[model samples]
Target: MNTQYTDSKIRRFTIFKRLLNYEHLSYQQLSEEYFVSRSSIANDISYIKKQFAKEDLSLTFDNSGTFFNGNEIQVQKLMKRVILQREEVMDIDNLLMNQIANVFHEAIEKREIDIPESHIENIVLSIYLIIFRSKQGYTIKLDGKNQLGRLFFEFDKYPIVYDLLKEVEKCGIYHFSTDEAQHLTYLIVGSGLRFFLKDEKIPFSFRDRIAILIQKVSEGLRVNLTQDNRLEEDLVVHLYQLFLRTDAQTTIVNPLISEIKQTYPSLFGVVWFALSDFCKPYQINLSDDEVGFVAIHFQAAVERLKKKNKILFVCPNGIGTSSYVSAKIRRILPDINSIETVSTSKLKSMDLSDVDFIISTVMISEQRKPVVTISPMVTSKDMKKIMNYYIDLIIYNEQKITEKFEFSYETRELIGKDIIFGNFSTKKDALDYLFKRQDFSDELLKEDFISSVWEREKLQSTYFDNGFAVPHGNPAFVEKTAISILILDKAIPWGNQMVDVIVLLLIREEDVEKVEPVMNLIMQGIEDKEWFISKMMEVRE
Candidate 1:
């Protein structure tokens, strides 16, 4: 049989032996005697009672106490079988000791402390060896100074030994004293070592010590194994406290956010956005640092939300088919926030500057923000397309911000035969040509094509110089493809600048995937002042 199975049998036998010894004891008393929880004791007692019943061995329990009347020899024989099956349990303890040694070795290699890896590993192994042998009924002898000797004997107490062993078994890291006697015992446990943490009583305040201890333990466990209970509890509590007192806006300023920024700055923007949304109900103000912390939580929450199909609904014109649209959206989106309804006139007038994405029945002309428009007769197919579009946009924006920025070499690198460049005399002229063309099959780009591109420009002026306005998608709202270059004979009012050279990129949903490869090229075209001016000067109708 597998050694793990044998170890399990031994554990079961140990529980059974303890139960047999205290057959008359109440479950609560048994729990105390075994140093296990009441539930564990009850479970063990229940299993033992079942076994007795299976064999037709009489057993009774009540207020008068419990008794077992059966073949004593047979009971002893069964107990021996369990004991024999558990012989490998001792080996498991030894293996755990060795695992501790390896952990210390790794920590040392990382140059975490001045202590030598070999020395730490040996010391931990020795300590565990002593404990393991002793647990197997062997006496341990120690020779060291009085303080060290006292620590070793105190460590032998069942409660302390059990606590330490349980921690090592569960967490794969045993924190023990580094006194000479304890070190010697640790060295003996190397054969069975799993991992070990030698307590370092450094010259620091209590709070500092706690922080240091938690850091060390978390680092060790995070690398050698999955995060343990202690780490999860500590991290979650730290985040909770950081967010608890913070208002939605200032939550981005926490130290945890700063740490994440240092490691991942690009993710900082998306994370900040998520934290802002999360803290919305609490009305907490977030700082950059707090935003970083919230980003981590947001990433985790989103992963879970994806599996559950969570969604939010937005509609313009509350009076029409908005309710029906909301119901259809609810069927597709899990964790659905209430469907929000706003009038088209109100939508056009109201500042939806901070809204995530708007889904509307009525098409508002001034959609200067992120909005997904659907017809009043929106069908299931329309819902699917809109949901997919929104989800893709969110994902794309996140990817864009997270990617590293690169410099482009020239304008020709991005604008070529497949990509055209020109300037428009008026926004109307540019709008007319882009929508009127039937060269492309993508309808989303053809329908309201001018407004969508113009909306992006309105968010921020795309003009890079006196003659150039590089109007492109927020890289978040693109659905279907086309890139247009319009050269205007005269300057026109574009956002905050007058422009003669306009490079309007019409990108399809699929083309957005190429943003990474062509990003540098686009940036290069915008940055070349002389080339951009030259291109504008040479533009024709």
Candidate 2:
């Protein structure tokens, strides 16, 4: 909210930039340069050290001065983080960002390159930093031994990427070395860019891998998606892009990852599990952002497979009221393709087999189809009721397997004395506490369980946006199903978001079916966090 930077912030930003450029200045020199006291300069250096610490780098002091101790890649990464965090402070050049973005668009339009719109900004930012750092005589040098480094050295293999770099060279007014050009190439291609050449071919094995992914997900969700040709085609392309990103050790930050995880918690988890299995054989590790992107394709396929609702309206009063209500309903919900209106007298004789649900002005005795009653003149309350019914209907139609997800006795029993209330400063502390409380069986190895949990966390953070985190290990490491709840006295950073409530979900392979309902309950809690936390307090009592 504070657009104006304080003197301290500006001084710190200047020092960060100088240090990023590998400058070493003592406290006295910085104090004289910034017109500040030696103590103020010391504070600035201390702040800079903390920032480096966050990135897992150390700022060392020697006879010369204090400097960041890292390699070229680490320096570049730290620069990016600092620039993004202090964008306003740095007064980033909008013209430069836009110029770089225009070059990418031009390349994409000319068919010289292809990339998803989501990653255009990533490339733009990286190039912006490259130009800035390169101009200052700091150039990236790739290590020859690593996979990415090897790919970088053989950059000419991707002729399209090499050509694109030439165009980028003109925009930045800098002749990039093999290492720099290849680094840019990796970014362009890894950010979901597709290379199309007349003689190029997609291997059959690649498509086979996608098929296995679909089959695994289909079996888990009990939905037959293998027959969907569109899903297969979409996934083939997406997985190729995924493979590129994974190989390059980079991924596009998915802005909708939180929403996707929250809205379709079960589907998201299933996709994560299925994709994890899919990537394992290839020894590829994907970020949660990638999983979220893949989940979107499957979620889209689910939407496509859903049956459009057909509503039957019954009004005993008159035809005018029925027509008006039907028109209103149609306006409110465009997804309903069919709406048949009839009087109460004719309703009994009409075929209910085709109707998914019945919306009536008067209460109708139990018909086979689900019935909802509303006033002849639809009020806001009535509209809300109708929308709620429609949402539940679509969710039911979309995921038929989750039809029986009500809070029953078993659901209550799943959350018992494991409820904990404490203050944890970090995600690891919260997870360590919850893991300690769990009663692991003889069949379960604690090390394996801990490793799987952290591994999953590394794959993608379990922190949801509802001030809660649901951390779980591989189900194979568990002998029983349990949901350990931890209500933090204060919220802690779990990953990208802050979590006040932590739900450590542990389950066995046999209880895989329970994932959906349990996730549904957590999602419901997220919708009304205050009420959920209050209820949690009562349980603690």
Candidate 3:
């Protein structure tokens, strides 16, 4: 009932921690313990109440005393926050923390649970907290509405969590009740790190949601990602756990969010926009970290879309020369993924559907795909011809994809009407110039539009490491689509980066499909500042 802290701040923290432990400390008890006035205790409680209100938690009192009035999950989060602030409260020397971590590492490796390195520390700390609290008889009491019981199924689905806790119990000389065990499992599941559940089947709901997500992104990129089974599987595994983590109100940190956003800016924007719709029904506002994770998957799918060229070797000459020519072509052109030698006779029957193009020693009269005729010896002149043809084929494919959009990055159509050349000193000045453009006069006038842009900017600066920023508003506020460009004459501070260019996206609700290509253009500029500025200057001229 009575405790001594070095200072009022520490005393307040202690009181908050005790409340998290389900303690109902009265003013009289706390004041008497601290050798302070009752009003001083009241001030402490008032300060604690303000902190609790920040998290939408209530610090209430009754005839018993003052305690945290919230669900188990909220209480546990507050406890974790408090302990993490002054980890000494959990363990003065961190001996117990290290001991629990070691036990966890052993059990985790034994179970072969594929947890991300970022999540391991949080998981270890959570397990230690559960055991520490249980030893002190601060056991979890779940109500009927608590999804931990239903979502986790009490460690039956994740026995590794159960086993880890059992191991901790052996090391710490403490026993966990059923509720404690269940709480520990909930903590693990909530971290959003579980992957490769070989024994567990992914729910159809998760798979279905992932399918819809892939389709949405596929439409945006003008490429079908649904056919990529690996992408589907990766997303299903990630998003299923993400749903569980959301339900549990847990967060997973992604250290590479900034790099990911810059590296795959186009893919990141597409994923972020698509996930905004995907998360609306659940009311789950995903953090940039989560969006970055999903964007990584889509970026992989984009790489898959750029499949290497597969060549079908056709030689009217005998098998010996055919083999020689195929070998020679392979040695010369490393870009070709595969070369299959086929006699001209068999070429008629062979499936050209699987082959990207035909590489032949003899001239083919008809061609299903593009045919490149080279010498039987693979001569120097023929090598140049083949290389040119291959280059043309790749360019052709890229052109076909860009054709899906009405505007290309090279053309002025995307940013022509809205492009500005200014020497703005601040980010707001640059954005203000873009917002007032005639291109966005119809759309940016809405108060909601400006508010949404600032709101998103506040969440995370759109600044890229490549010396540019791609600031955007919420798609919901956009009715007419526009890509506003601000090419600064001098570099200005934007978030953590110095930006000489700003590509502000005003994407409409219906045309969300265009986000990818538009972002691709912006990223292209970011990668080559010289070329992008020259192009914009050319457009201006």
Q: Which predicted model would earn the best TM-score?
A: 2
- In TM-score terms, candidate 1 sits at 0.27
Please write out the lDDT profile of model 2 over residues 1-541, one tens digit for every residue. 2222238887798888888777888988877777778888888877777666434457778999988766676676666666555456775767777777787678777974555565776677777877877777887887753463342234556787777667777764567787777677667766643454234445787789889888767765667888899999888777765665554444356668777766776687778667765775555555566778999999888878877789998887777887789889998899897998887788878878879899998988888889999998899899899989999987776565434234556666777557777898988888888888878765248779889889877765566545867778877789778888988889887654567988888878667556655666666577667766666666542
Q: List ranges where model 2 is wrong by over 4 Å.
A: 1-71, 74-87, 94-104, 112-114, 144-156, 170-172, 197-227, 246-291, 313-336, 339-345, 350-408, 422-471, 486-502, 520-533, 537-541
- Candidate 3, residues 329-411, lDDT tens digits: the string is 88778877789888778888877887888988887779788898887888999888888888888888756643322346534
Model 2 residue 147 CA deviation in Å: 4.0
Better of 1 and 3 by lDDT: 3
Models 1 onward score TM values of: 0.27, 0.67, 0.53
Q: Model 3: which ten-residue window has the lowest total lDDT?
A: 402-411
User: How much is the lDDT of residue 225 in candidate 1?
Assistant: 16
- Answer with 1 or 2, whichever has the higher lDDT: 2
Q: lDDT ranking from best to worst?
A: 2, 3, 1
Q: List the residue pairs that clash in candidate 3.
A: none
List ranges where model 1 is wrong by over 4 Å: 1-233, 236-320, 334-339, 375-378, 405-541
Candidate 1 local lDDT, 23-64, one digit each (tens): 466766655655566777666656665544322243557885
Please give the lDDT score for candidate 2.
Answer: 0.73
RMSD over all Cα atoms, model 1 = 28.8
